[model samples]
Target: MDPEVDTTQGGLRIDGRRPLELRRIRLRLGVFSQADGSAYIEQGNTKILATVYGPHQPRGKSVSSMTKATKGIVNCQYSTAVFSFGAGERKKRPRGDRKSIERAQQLKHAMEAIINLELFAKSQMDVFVEVLQVDGSEFCVAVNAATLALIDAGIPIKDYAVGCSITVSDKLLGDDDSGKSTGILDANWVEECSPGVTLSIVALPKVVDETETKSSVILAHGAGQRLHLSQLESLRLRALQGCKDIRTIIDQAVKDHLQIFVVTTALDK
Candidate 1:
């Protein structure tokens, strides 16, 4: 863990952000007229495009086997452009590579958790995510982008499923050095590569109403380094908060876009 890259030092990070600060997220919905739904997003320097199709009959044999007995299946294909990486960074894997395949499955699982699969039983919904640029938190950005695309495609979901990442650094919770670890939110590539535990979470947008709760967390994945059991709760909380924040941003963006679209259609008519 190079001190130069550690954002958990109770100081601003390398990119001039506080520990819990997220990169600026800019997104547009329905970017492609041909697809059922499509979106483009930029989270920090990571740019991604997502397209959604289907909710139609499962045609291909590969898709047929994956269809659930009663609930429709969600299929995902994830890829990164060959030139998406920064100069001197490692080249990206080709499409259908093992890494891409695994990420595709992960994205698929996140989508399946919120989508009303029973609404289209014996069918399939396909989501495609392309990483146009990579800076960090690519998967989180991709998840958010896919969610927007699904919404643009008019898919009904129980609630918004958002993704966020948290990284626990050497910072201690209390005064002493031996205190419990403190986790930071929305890790960029530098923090992700730093020597620490990075936790990626996919969760439904948190609601204050206790009576309105079903499940808060949909998925939690740990990477980079091993974390102590004591830090898990704090990390989970931080990630969930990030999910809630992201969901708010997305919700506002969608509403703004729809208002603009409504005015544009009115003018055209």
Candidate 2:
């Protein structure tokens, strides 16, 4: 572990955020006039733009003959600006590389899990995400931006698939009122790239009865050092809380946009 990566600076993180404190999240929907739907988001220094198109005809690689018979299809493409990498890192070509393709596929599955694919039988939904700035929690930001775009396109979904990430520092702080481990939530590029366990989660941000069987988690991915079994639950709770908080922000943005649109239309009439 790097000595400088010590995130528990008196219970504060590298970016001056306390445990469970999320980065500043700002999002806007219907950002583009031509696309069926579009959105842009900024989480700390990580910024992403997502656009959604279609419920239109499914053709080419986006759909196959068999898929057209069974249900709708989703095609996701993720890309990064050439300058989006960290400042000191060598700038690489941003062509459809293997990493981007894998990220795209992962994002597509996350969206598919929430979408009512059966409703758009024989159709296709195309989602394109572009990373304008590079930072940690890249994948989670992509998932979030895409979800808002889908909503803007008026696609029906079972639930909001919110994404959040957490990272463990070399030391733990348990002096807070909760007396729980102060795990790092919403790591920045510097903290995330250093060294430690990092976990990313995408899930439905809903409260369900403990007696019920359904779960909120859709996907959980981890990288860096292996996390201990004991700490997993704590990390899960922090990430889930972050997800729930973000969902609330997105919902408010959508409602605000709608209210503005309604007022504009009323005046035009």
Candidate 3:
């Protein structure tokens, strides 16, 4: 952490954002015509695209029945393009690698929690996320991307499955300092690859219902460095803020898409 990057003293930092601020966000729906639904989201230098296919026949015996049993099935495939600027200076296959498989599984689990599975039993929904650029919070960004795709597919979700990653870095000491820990809101590749602890959270867009029902947090993940239980609260709070910020941007995107959709239908009629 750079003292120059101090959030307390400095009024506002790069991008004119407060300490916990997120970058400007933009989302576009139906970017691809062939897929059932597709969306692209850009957050600073991080760019991700997601596509949905299915609510169709399941691939295997297990999947076919599992989906039909009571809820819809969400199959997620997460991959980064070999040419994506972030995967490090290398040439290699784009998907089906070990890392990609693990990412895919994580994504699937998170989505399963949000989607109303019972509605489309015996059917499958495929969500494919492709990283166009690499930044600190790829996994979280991919989750955000997948959420949009699901929405585009007209899938029913209790709430948006927003995701974000928080990094705890050392500020006072050198990069090696163990005691200097500062929690960063959203990390890009440089922040991610650095020595630190990262926590990923999948949270529902918080809502204050007059009905007096409390909101729920679905999934949380701690990776890289082990953090004390005491630190969990702060980390979770930061992650939730990030999720809320993402949800706002996605909400705008959805509205824009719907407006256009309505206009097109009106014209057709």
List the lowest-lDDT window of 10 residues for candidate 3: 171-180
User: How close is every model to the real structure, measured as TM-score?
Assistant: 0.88, 0.89, 0.85
Query: Candidate 2: TM-score?
Result: 0.89
The candidate with the higher lDDT, 2 or 3, is 2
State the lDDT of candidate 3 residue by residue for 76-123, as single tens digits.
Answer: 888888878744565386789998898899899888988888777777
RMSD of each: 3.2, 3.3, 4.1
**Alpha-carbon lDDT, every model:** 0.82, 0.82, 0.75
Off by over 4 Å in 3: 1-17, 61-68, 86-88, 172-182, 209-215
Candidate 2, RMSD to the unseen true structure: 3.3
Model 1 pairs whose backbones collide: none
Clash counts for all predictions: 0, 0, 15
